[model samples]
Target chain A: MIAFRNVTHGYGDGPLLSDVSLTLPPGSFHFLTGPSGAGKSTFLKLCYRELMPIAGTVEIFGQDVSHMSRDAVAMARRKIGVVHQDCQFLDHLPLADNVALPLTVAGREANPEELKELLAWVGLSGHARARPPSLSGGERQRAALARAVITAPEMVLADEPTGNLDWDMSQRLLTLLVELNRMGKTILIATHDMNLIRTAKSQVAARVLRIRDRTVQHAGADL
Target chain B: MKAPLPRKFRLFGRDTRTDRVVPPSGAAAWLTLLTAAAMAFLAVFALALSVATGRLADRWSEALANGATVRISAPADQMATQTQRVLDILSVTPGVETARALDPAETQALLSPWFGPDLPVASLPIPQLIDIQETPQGFDAEGLRLRLSAEVPGATLDDHQRWRRPLVAAADRMRMLGLISLALIGAAMAAMVTLAAMAALSANGQVIRTLRLIGARDGYVARAFVRRFTTRTLTGAAAGTAVAMTAIALMPSAGDAGGFLTDIAFQGAEWLWPLTIPPLAAIVAFVATRTAALRSLRTVL
Candidate 1:
């Protein structure tokens, strides 16, 4: 669960998300909508404690992330899987290793059979030995999705996860996230794609939050 | 396809899998290795110099402690009687092992190196000298000097303090210099490793970001670099130490009579000392790389 109370953040020019207070309940699926450079990624970063807000508090799992030590932040992050839009990967590592990174960083051994099945589920079984740089954009996005859920985290915060995926691939990735939500993993995704949000709404009950005028507001049923 | 690396290795702890997280940085890794090797090579020589100078100091001290010179500077007619009195006094001394007056020819031999044989010893009013060998515990030098000054007015005891102090002190200074050189080598190794680590960390910033994105702790990420750098330093230092020891062994050894520089080497069990260089270099690498990794992680992560 994540709670941001009066959180204001910016990159020195002006406040991007100001006076924002929101709570993400457990097992809930939410979509964050905003135009380009509208602080969507910044909002996700605040949830995972990657960057602290300029003002106010951001709490994850009932603990203030600002007061968390580096180690404590790391421990908190294990429970909150984050998927970025660029979907960075260790290029030197093979696809399977990259996908299993969450489990590896958690210092838990990934069962080879389970890992093979996870790659198969992501449709990257054939690219298991391939490195990240060699993978296509769509392949990389699926791999990122597989990595995020590999640790079976309690919450999944994704920033434009399917930004590089095709329509079918995005639908498949969206279905995977919806399935995770059905399994009681909280999911929050930031995207400008209205189609993806509309399709997600049909599949599961999802609330939409829009970032505009430097604050987050409950989006109207415009889409 | 090659087999996958086993994900479960507890070699350095349960986190051995964390060791290889950093991509293999060829240039930086080699830099650490070469720096460690060079420093270790210098360290080996410094250790050898310290050991050799220590031995030289002990040898000079021992030689000085074992002997004394008593010189009689009376009129030519009274020289023999004064020399005889000096010898008699030494014979009754508690720690005197042996005492005898130097023959004119023997005394002339001692002066030949400096003054040449043209300065004839027998005709000149040169002082009569008696050589005295002492017991291990040795006689009280101050007491003996007082007795000789009073009993034989023109006789003086030279316990070799003036000669021994400077020689021993010079050797001690050389040994201290060697020790200081070793410390500097260690410091240089640390600096080199730190620079190399920083370079590697900077180059691998994306790797660190990726790892952090996947929920790795700073300690987890740091262990990867620390283990790599530490092992590389250990291996390089070991190679360098072996090569230096071999090079030193091959050098011409003049033994105790040989010139000090020519005889610089680890004697006997002292050869085991250079074996420590590798581990110490490894420790230096561990600390340096770990510090650099953590600091960089704090900045970038």
Candidate 2:
């Protein structure tokens, strides 16, 4: 669970999200819809402690993000999986190694069969030896998803995970998120895709929040 | 699943290989390795020099301190009488172990190399020499010289101190020079290692940034770089030491051949001294690279 108490975040000389207060309850799924430059990625970064809020506090599982040490933050991140839009990876490593990196950094040896199965779940089983630069956009996104959930984190935060995918690919990624939600993994996805949000809404009871005017408003059925 | 400890937190594990090896053309890596190798070689030479000088000093002190020569350069007729008087005086001394007159043949053998073997030693009036050996607490040179001057008018006592002191002083200076060379070698190693570590960190900028983004601490990142450089230095120094030892071992032996340079080698168990160089090089590289990496990472992060 994450709580942002009256968070006012902004870059120098301008406010992106001001006086925003929100709490994500345990096991709740939400969709954050915002226009360009609306601080959606910035909000997700705050949730994971990548970027501390300028004036307010963000809490994860009751621990203050602003006060956590680097190790403590890394440990906290293990419980919350994140899928960046670009899907960064150590390019020199193979796809399988990249997918198992979270486990590697955590110093846990991966069971080869389990890792293969995880890759299979993401439809990248055959591309285990492939390099990141060689993977397609959709493959990379799926690989990122596999990497994110490798630790079986309690919460999933995704920023435009399917932005570069085709309609069919987007629907597939949405299905993966929906499956994770069904398994009681809280999910918050920030995107501008209305069709994707509507499709997610039909499949599960996902509350949609729109970020505009430096505040979050309930978009409700209008989304 | 149980969370595992990070690499830095592990007490013991498999050796960590360098994550970033500069290509063969990597200027920094080659420069560091070459610099370390050169310094290690110089250190080996300095070690050999110091050991040699120590041996020389000990030999000169022991051999010269226990012996004296009384040269009786009197009128040809009185030479034998004066030699007898000087010998008698030395024989009565408490610390004198043995005193004997050197006959013509024995004195001729001492001059054989310089003057030809056909020297007319019996015809020419060479001074009568009386050699005196002493116990550990040797007879006082000044006391014996005073006694010889009163008893044998032409007797001049040579305790070899004049020659021995200069040789000892020269040996001591050589040892000091060796020590200074060793210190400079260590400084050069530390400087080269620090530069190499900085270069490696800069080259692996992306790896560092990625690690930082993933929440790695400064110590964790520093361990990787430090471990890599320390291994490299040890390996390089080992190679250098081996080459130096082999070169020294192949040097001409001191047995009637190569003169002083031959004696300039490791004595007895002194061979063990050069063995310490590689490990010492490792410790230097470890400290140098670790400090450099940690300091640079702090600024960058």
Candidate 3:
């Protein structure tokens, strides 16, 4: 449950996302679509409290993001999973350890069986012993997805999950996200890929919101 | 059904995976260790100096506090008579414990180092010296000086206060200087450790960002750096302390040749003091690294 109320954010210049208001309800799936440099990634950052709104308020789990302490922000992040466009990983570590990082940071032991199963779900079962730098682009994206969901967070926000993947791989990753949504996990993905959006519509019902002219608008069936 | 709890999170526990999150900073690690060793070596010497100077001060104060010297300078014919008169004055003094005039052989032995062994003591007009020991409650030197001036014009009573006070003060000042040197060494170690930690934190910025993305707190991130530095410092300091203690143990003892520099070593229970350097170095490293890590984490994370 993340809500942005009339949030306006920008770099030093003018606002890139202006007067935006949106609510991500529990167990709902949404897709953010826009042209390049249209503040889709910035919007995603606001949801996870990585960047605060310069104007208006951003709330995560009914708590104001601006008022939370650094420690409180970390605790709030445990409930939200984010997948970056580059799919960051601790390259020195093996794939299994990288995926189990969330549990480790939470000061809990990673279950070997659960990790094995999660790696299998992400099609990274064979690459468990391999380092992150050795994985392919699609494998790395899937591994990032596995890491995101390993904590069983309530909400998942992904930025350009399929930017570096082929069509087949993108569909595979989309299917994985659809399966998670079916299991009652709220999902919001930001991307400029129209084909991926059409494909996502065939698999599951997802509302598409397009960012244009520094504002978010609900793009109905026309998109 | 409930899951079982994990093992206790030990402060010194070895978690290879968690430690690997921040890559080993090879140069910084070696620098920290070497600096800690050097500081610890200097710290051991400083401690020895402090303890040795303190002992010297106490010895000098105790030996000089209750003693005085009566020097009788007279014509060669009246030397024995003047010595006899000085001894008689000391015997009647209230706080005089024992007084004896030094024999010619004893005076020759005292002057042997300066004038060599074969000096003709009977022919020369050397003054007669009477060694006087005082009671616990010593006699007043002013009163004794007036009496000696009135009774025997050639006799001067020196209570050794002027020389003894300065000697004791010099030793005490040396002890303070040793302590100040130790403090400066500790401060230098801390500064070096802080710089090394900052460099490591800056070099591992990506590692910190990745850790923060995964919901790791500042304390968790700081622990990785702190534990590494503290262990390195402790190990290095232990090695330095061991070497220093061995070197001190092999130093020449202060027996007959009681030169000040020769006695610059631990005495008796004082040997155990150097053993504290390792733990103290570890504590310094821990504090320095923890401070640098947390401050840098705030900026980067």
Candidate 4:
């Protein structure tokens, strides 16, 4: 449900992602792969309207990202879930409260049973009372994943979801993502892990895109 | 089956989840409270001064508006004749309510404070004084002065306007100054609150970023800070107002002491005015904090 038409972005320097045109259709699963500093995180930011494209237009759910007001951007974000590489959380809050934050910010009543089941699905049921800083890296990633899908958003954009996880933990996280895709949720993940890509391809029908030398290219059957 | 999640309490019509994200900045919180308290205390005094000066101006204007005094300075023998001539002139004046010359003993009473009660009144050269009372629509002092100068050259009419006008004007000016001081105090409080809120927002930059990333709107983020500062200001101002009202109540009454300082206090229903300070302080804090929070959130989110 996200479209970037010739979207060019930069940070006071030259363009990071130049003349990039891509479409993330509904119920589709895609992987973004490139080396370090290949503008992968920047691509996900544009998808969520965190950063506006300097050159062309970026659209989410058919609304122009650059034209949306601050409040409209926030409302649009509720429809798309984002899992960051750092797995940002309010360190002062417990893990359960952090995961329930999306519903809380939207001014909706949190269904305790649903929140519990979501936490259990991500295997963070026992760690609900724990703080973010107190949790292990892998546990934090799972908590982040649970938080992302807590709102039942239509699309999920994750930036290096398993950056800090081991091989088995990464596989487990991949399985959760695969299940979500099977349930008709669009998923786009950016990563540099080739093994994670290989594992994801065997589990689900997915296309791979890579960002290199300031442009996005469809990597053809290389994996 | 998964266990049910416990419901958290809602504060100020919103769930407390958003508020818990920002860690409390203890120093900034206390600074806002103390600033509000101090500003409120000063505001009470300013209100009192304005009210008291207004009363003083009204009293002076009413008492001195229609009254005049006739001072007769002449030879001892001619003083009686001049006084009689002045009295006769005043009796025909349309606005003159009553005119009576002061007796020797009454004149001595006026001088008792400076010359002691046993002053030699008969031998002294103090001028003969005649008190003149006017109707509600008073006579013209200039017209009467010309009449007395022709009929009784030694007689001089003083309608108390020379001194009364200045006294009334001074009181009115004091009232205006008191009001201006209250306005300045309010502005200063707002400025201090704005600075404190900005500091708190800056210190919690990470918290704001995290909240916005989770789809929290600017209003949601601003409310958390606004409610906190408003509550603190209200509580502190209440305490300050209580102390100020008690101090004002203990002040000497104007009727008993009869002086400027004694009159600088609340009288009757005027005590109810200071009670509004706490609520007003809360409003100021709400506006100041909301403005700072939203402005800072723009740069953050």
Candidate 5:
């Protein structure tokens, strides 16, 4: 769960998100929508304590982000999975190891069978031995998704999960996220994809939050 | 479901999944390895110098410690009388173990090195020399000087301290300089390794960012780099130490080179001293890399 109260953030030019207050309860599925460079990623970063709020408070799992130590942030991150549009990875490592990284870094022994199943679920079973540099964009997205949930994180924050994927691939990635939601894992995805939002809404109850005019607003019944 | 890693993958503890996160090859890796090897090589010679000077000091001290000389510079007519009086006074001196005047032939042999053997020793005004050996508790030079001045004005006591102190002091100072050189070498190695570590960390910025986003702690990230550098330094230093030790073992003995180098080598159990350099280099690399990694991780995170 994440809570942002009067949160203001920017990159020194002007306020990108100003006086924004929102509390994402446990197990809630929400989508953040905005144009390019509209501070969606910044919001997610604040959620995971990767960036500090210029004003006000941001809390993850009921703890204030400003007061958390580096290790505390790391601990919080273990329970909060992040999927990036770029799907960055240790490119030298194989796909399976990249997917299993969250567990590996968390000091949890990843079961080989379960890791294989997770890769299969994401349709990356055949590319398990392939390095990140060799994987296709869509494959990398799915691999990123697989990596995000490999540790069974309680909350998943994805920044444009299917940014570079095809429509069908996007829908497939949405379905996987929906499946995770059905498993009671909270998910917040930032995207400009209305079709994906519509597809996700039909499959499960979801809320859409739009970032505009430097604030987050509930865009319910509009999209 | 999992396949085995390649043979090269297991290098630098990549056998462990935790350590494989960072890509192993980089300029920093070789920097640390080569720096360690070169510094270790230089350090072996520095150690040899220190050890050799210390040995020199000890040998000089042992050879010159309990010995003194008496020179009679009286007129040719009185030389025998003054030499006899000097010997009689030294014979009764406490802690004087033995005192005997060298014969004319012995004196000629002593002077033969500087003056040719054909020199007329008995005709020349060469001083008569008396060799004096002392007990473990040696006689006081001031007391002996006073007695010799009153009893035999021509006789002067030479306890060897005038020249012995300077020789021993010079050797001791050389040993100190060698030790200081070794310390500087170690410090330079640490600095080189630190710079190399920072470069490696900077070059792997993407890897570090990716790892952190995946919930990896700073320590986890640092461990990957630390282990890699430490292992490289250890291996390189071991090789360097080996080569240096071999070179030292092949060096000429003390008697060779006209006794100028003065046993500049390890003797008996001293060979074990060079064996410690590799492990010490490993330790320096470990500390330097860890510190740089941790400090740089703070800034990155």
Candidate 6:
């Protein structure tokens, strides 16, 4: 669970998002939509403690994100899966190894069978031995997804995960996310694609939140 | 976080030793091996110099501190009389163990290198030398000198104190200088290795950033580099030490006509002393790299 109470974030002299109050409960599915530079990624980053709130409080699982120590934040991140916009991977490692990185960072053994099954689920079973740089955008996204879920985190946050995918590929990725939600993993996705938001709505009870005028608003009511 | 992970975790985790080895190319590994070997070679000699100087100081101080010589430079007829009188005085002296006049052949042997074996010592007015030996509770030089001056007016006493003091002092200073040089070499090695580690860390910024993005604690990331550099330094030091030891072992022994420089080597159990350098180097690398990594990580993060 995550709660941002009147949170305000900014760069040196400009406010990106201000007075943004929101709550994401367990097993909830939410879509964040906004135009370019709307602070969607920054908002998702705060959820996992990558960037701290400049003002106000961001809480995850009852611990204050801004107050948590570095180790505490790292341990907390083990329970939250984050897929970056670029779908970052350790380039030198094989795709399978990259996907198993979460388990590795957590100091847990990666079960070979479980890793194979996770790759299979991401449709990257054939690319297990392939290096991350050799994988296509879609494959990279799927691998990032696999990495995020490897620790069996309770929540998943993704930023434009379908940005480089075709319609069919986007749908396949969304279906994977929906299945995770069905299995009780809370999910929040930030995207600019309205079609993707509409598609996610029809499949699951996902609420759409739009960042406008430096504030988050319920999308259905406004647009 | 929970009671600190085992060293096995530190050892086998992809982050530490396995990740940084850069896959050994024969050339690179050999270069590392050679570097270690050469440094070790020099280090061994430095160690030997330090130990040998210490021994020389101890020997010079011990041998010269407890002995004196009496030389009588009179006519051959008076030489025998003066020698007998000096011996009579020494017989009553407190710490004089024995005083004996040198025979003609023994005197010639001392002068052979300078004046040749055919020098006419019987005709020329060379002084008759008395070789004096002393007990641990040595004779009073001033007291015996006064007695000899009164009894044998032509006698000149050489207690070896004037020359011995300076020789022992010089040896002691050389021993100190050798120790100081060894310390400076260790410091220089640490500084060089620290710079190398920092360069390596800077070169691998992407790796560090990736690790950080994945939520690795600073300690985990630091340990990766710390262990890496520690091993490199240890290996380097080991190679350096081995080459140094072997080269020192092959150095000319003092018994040979080897000059002082050639005679610089470990004696007795002094050889075991170089074994401590590798572990010491490892500790230095650990501390130096850890400080560099932590400082750099803090600045960037």
Ranked candidates, highest lDDT first: 1, 3, 4, 5, 2, 6
For residues B16-41, could you state the per-residue lDDT of candidate 4 as single tens digits?
Answer: 66567668788888888888888899
Looking at candidate 4 chain A, the ten consecutive residues that score lowest on lDDT are A164-173
Q: Write the per-residue lDDT of candidate 6 for residues A30-115, one digit (tens) a residue.
A: 99988989999989988887777888999999988767877777778788888888787767777887888777666677999999
Over A1-223, each residue of candidate 3 has an lDDT whose tens digit, in order, gives: 8888999999989999999988888888899999989899999888887788999999988999999888888888888889987788988788899999988988888899999998987778999999988988888888898899899888899999988788877887888788889988899999888899988888888999999899999898789
| Model 1 C-alpha lDDT per residue in residues B1-301, reported as the tens digit of each score | 8875543211234455676578888778788778888889999999999999999999999989799999889999998788888888888999999998889899889999899987788888898888889998889999999999889999989999899999999999999999999999999899989998898899989899888867788888888888788889988999899999999889897765677888798778998999999989988888898899999999743
What Cα-based lDDT does every candidate model obtain?
0.88, 0.81, 0.88, 0.87, 0.86, 0.79
- For model 2, what is the alpha-carbon lDDT of residue B64? 86
Q: Which scores higher on DockQ, 4 or 5?
A: 5
Q: Considering just chain B, what TM-score does every model have?
A: 0.88, 0.90, 0.92, 0.90, 0.91, 0.88
lDDT of 4 by residue, A1-223 (tens): 8899999999988999999999989999999988889899999999987788999999998999878888888888898889988888888888998999898889887799998998887778898899899998888988988889888888898999888888887888889889889999999999888888888889898889999889988899766
lDDT of 5 at A154: 91
What does candidate 6's lDDT look like per residue over B193-263, in tens digits? 67776776787676666666666666767777777667777788897888778777876666746645765
lDDT winner between 2 and 3, please give it: 3
CA displacement after TM-score superposition, residue B274 of candidate 4 (Å):
1.3
For model 2, how does the per-residue alpha-carbon lDDT over B44-121 read when each residue is reduced to its tens digit? Answer: 999998888878788888888888888889888888787778777887998999999999999999989999899999
Give the DockQ (2 decimals) of all models: 0.69, 0.26, 0.68, 0.69, 0.75, 0.40
Model 4 residue A98 distance off true place after TM-score fit, in angstroms:
0.8
* Runs of candidate 3 exceeding 4 Å displacement: A202-205, B1-10
Indicate the worst ten consecutive residues by lDDT in candidate 2 chain A.
A100-109
CA deviation > 4 Å runs, candidate 6: B1-35, B254-256
Q: What lDDT score goes with residue A208 in model 3?
A: 95
Cα lDDT, model 3, residue A25:
88
Flag regions of model 5 displaced more than 4 Å: B1-15, B254-257, B260-262
TM-score for chain A in each prediction: 0.97, 0.95, 0.94, 0.95, 0.96, 0.94
TM-score for candidate 2: 0.83
* DockQ of model 6, rounded to 2 decimals: 0.40
Candidate 5 residue-wise lDDT, A99-141, digit = tens: 9899888877889999999898877889989999998888888
- Model 1 residue B141 CA deviation in Å: 3.5
Best by DockQ: 5
